[model samples]
Target: MSETIPAGKGISAAQSKIENRLIETVVESFNKTEDPRLKVLMQSLTRHLHNFLREVRLTEDEWRTAIDFLTTAGHITDGKRQEFVLLSDVLGLSMQTIAMNNQAYKGATEATVFGPFFLENAPEIAIGGDIAGGAAGQPCWVEGTVTDSSASPVPGARIEVWEADEEGFYDVQYGDGRIAGRAHLFADENGKYAFWGLTPTPYPIPDDGPVGQLLESVGRSPVRASHLHFMVSADGLRSLVTHIFVAGDPQIEIGDSVFGVKDSLIKSFETQPAGTPTPDGRDLDGKAWARTRFDIVLAPALT
Candidate 1:
């Protein structure tokens, strides 16, 4: 069937009707919600969605196709995975939100979008321990300090860390619970923490949706830079979700398919001995990798 709108179909009039109905539905739903945040979110989303439809002069067929794509995205999701987060990442919406909310940390430590693969069960390890579990990749020791904005150490802070293996795959991606290149470490009494993990590598976002099509259409690559994800929390300090990008990783400058790259987030990954005993207390020599120290300074909570 030809997917063209029929002549004299009153496109504008139809759009007006649909838009009015949408606004009414949104207002009704918002009124039924008690959460202030949800109300703001729903109202803003409704206004923007309506504006977008009107601006684009969307046709019924296109809207239906879009809905179908979204449905398929949901269908593709299962335990240990989320296609919606993938969708958000590909559209750059995730990074945009992180950037907007982290504006206060611009000069301090830039934030990036957390991908869908981070799992909470990262094995806990001591300082100088390895998160690589046992993956083949460049050996890198990541050390850093967790502190408040004033540069005072926040000892006993918990840092949740995870990254892809040397082969550019996370534990979830591998689907084997290997937990390679992932760990959770606690800051010592000095607020200092360090661990070893395989240096990250550029990897592609899933490319099987409208978002993927959008990236291809724009002549963009779906690769993200090598980086380690970190979520740090401590008493009396605001929590932070951030990443440490490998400096000089070509992907950092060009291939962040999610638009999440920032100069401030990049750090040098220095060469280290390969014979470094694996994080498991076993001697594994000749494992070449990079090392870097990253310090995170958090903002004090507003009373």
Candidate 2:
């Protein structure tokens, strides 16, 4: 025998039927997609998106607000500023994508977000040279070695480094087309590299746009811990993009705004008094300096 439904239950069941038909129609529209992967992706995306809308009983106003926020984020993006990447970062989507793509490897350095600030074709600097370019900050000596998984030095690997100054400003922030605290260098025959850079200081992710507004609405701080960025690459090895975070930085303990910090990537920066001999023999004018050593291990490239 057929069961009778109450009046409210009947209405709900009819509404659910309409929702299911809409989802099914949207998903079926992608059935003719040329790429198998794209077809699957579109179908899955439609299903999940429809489910989320139903689960939330989303209002039209809320959906419109989200659309407007994303539109504003795109409108503000330019050559030196990337608001979309910043949004992904603050939302932790960037780190989640990185983690999914970069599986852990024994002895290889853990990868982190390839922040929006990386510039292509950065001017190459000689070993032990100063990358700070007289930018304002305490003198810091950065020395490191590049090796393979087996611990053998991988000489001649390319290392690209960039960081903010003591005042917590990147070169791009100045908008003067001046390059500071960023350079490319190569490891020596013994896989050793050293350069002079400024001590990294905590700074906010460019929070002047919609992403910033989102952070404010969520009661979240926009500060990133002090860190030096690196992109190391060698032939026949998978490139490593990562950062060396300052040990004991309050932001690191509290959590980096971009979710990029890994406990394994933190290293202490030792303080040296003024007049100490610099590792690169560059004259520091008797200024007190900080120094740290980082070693990198690369994994073999997938064939």
Candidate 3:
């Protein structure tokens, strides 16, 4: 057999020179960036992007398609929808970034993706109150304590919680502009908190946009495991963003669509019969309810 030729071996010298010059010009354009970090980021991004194009031998049509895809993703993004974040989630880039930034700390809760659904300044509720906000789902009682790495109580900690209803829909999913199943509360003086929420259930990521189409093209499902989202913070401690996934959620063994689950974050949701007294003495009055406990351990903040 004749010897095989290496790829790009037939390119003329002029073509090779133009490719090199293009990358060099792009990198040099960032040399005047006022911020050193920004300069480094731009140069590195330019080099890597050029290398990727060369490695893939990307076609002009493919580049145009990518640009169009990004443009569509941007256009579909709005206050309640985040297509870019959805893209990153489906790509596993969000999990990779979270892992790199949140190295394991002793006794501290592991951090996970913030998710695209988190709302800032959610309505605050008092302890033992319900966050269901008239959403439809089986009732659940979530109780937990905030503690330092040493397991000492951290009073007055802020805890923000949000989740979808049993039907796998969040408050934002409704078109009538109603908020449900989300609330923020402060821990009691004993570092304890309790609130009623809906039982966590599996749900599909919003799948009507460009990101959804991308997942379909790749033959990937958009279903995430059942879980309740939490953001816990206190003075002098590093805030934790995490989830307590429902134990035995079938999707738990399967990978989460957003790659958010950690084995340490799974907990059982104990089902109580009707008329069971809740931790705060709220009578379920013959309605089944679920209860779960999740204590958060926070690391000391850096000075």
Best by TM-score: 2
Identify the superior model by TM-score, candidate 1 or candidate 3: 3
Residue-level lDDT tens digits of model 1 in 2-96: 12222233567675665667666765667767898997788777777766676677899999988998888788787777889988887778988
Candidate 3 colliding pairs: 275-286
lDDT (Cα) of model 2 = 0.88
Using lDDT as the yardstick, the better of models 1 and 3 is 3
lDDT by residue for model 3 (53-146), tens: 8668899999999999999999989898898999998888998998887778787999898888889878999998899999989999999899
Of the two candidates 1 and 2, the one with more favorable lDDT, higher being better, is 2
TM value for model 3: 0.93
What is the lDDT, from 0 to 100, of the residue 121 in candidate 1? 75
Score each candidate by Cα lDDT. 0.76, 0.88, 0.88
Question: Lowest-scoring 10 consecutive residues by lDDT in candidate 2?
Answer: 1-10
Which residue pairs show collisions in model 1?
A: 138-289, 139-289, 270-291, 274-286, 274-287, 275-285, 275-286
Please provide, for model 2 over 1-303, each residue's C-alpha lDDT reduced to its tens digit, 9 standing for 90 to 100: 112222243348777777777787888888789999998888888888877777777899999999999999889998888999999999889999989777887768999998888888878999988899868999889998999998999999999999988888888989999999999999999999999888888999888899999999999999999999999999999998999998988998777999999988999999999999987577878889999999999988872
Q: Model 2 compared with the native: what TM-score? A: 0.94
lDDT of 3 at 72: 95
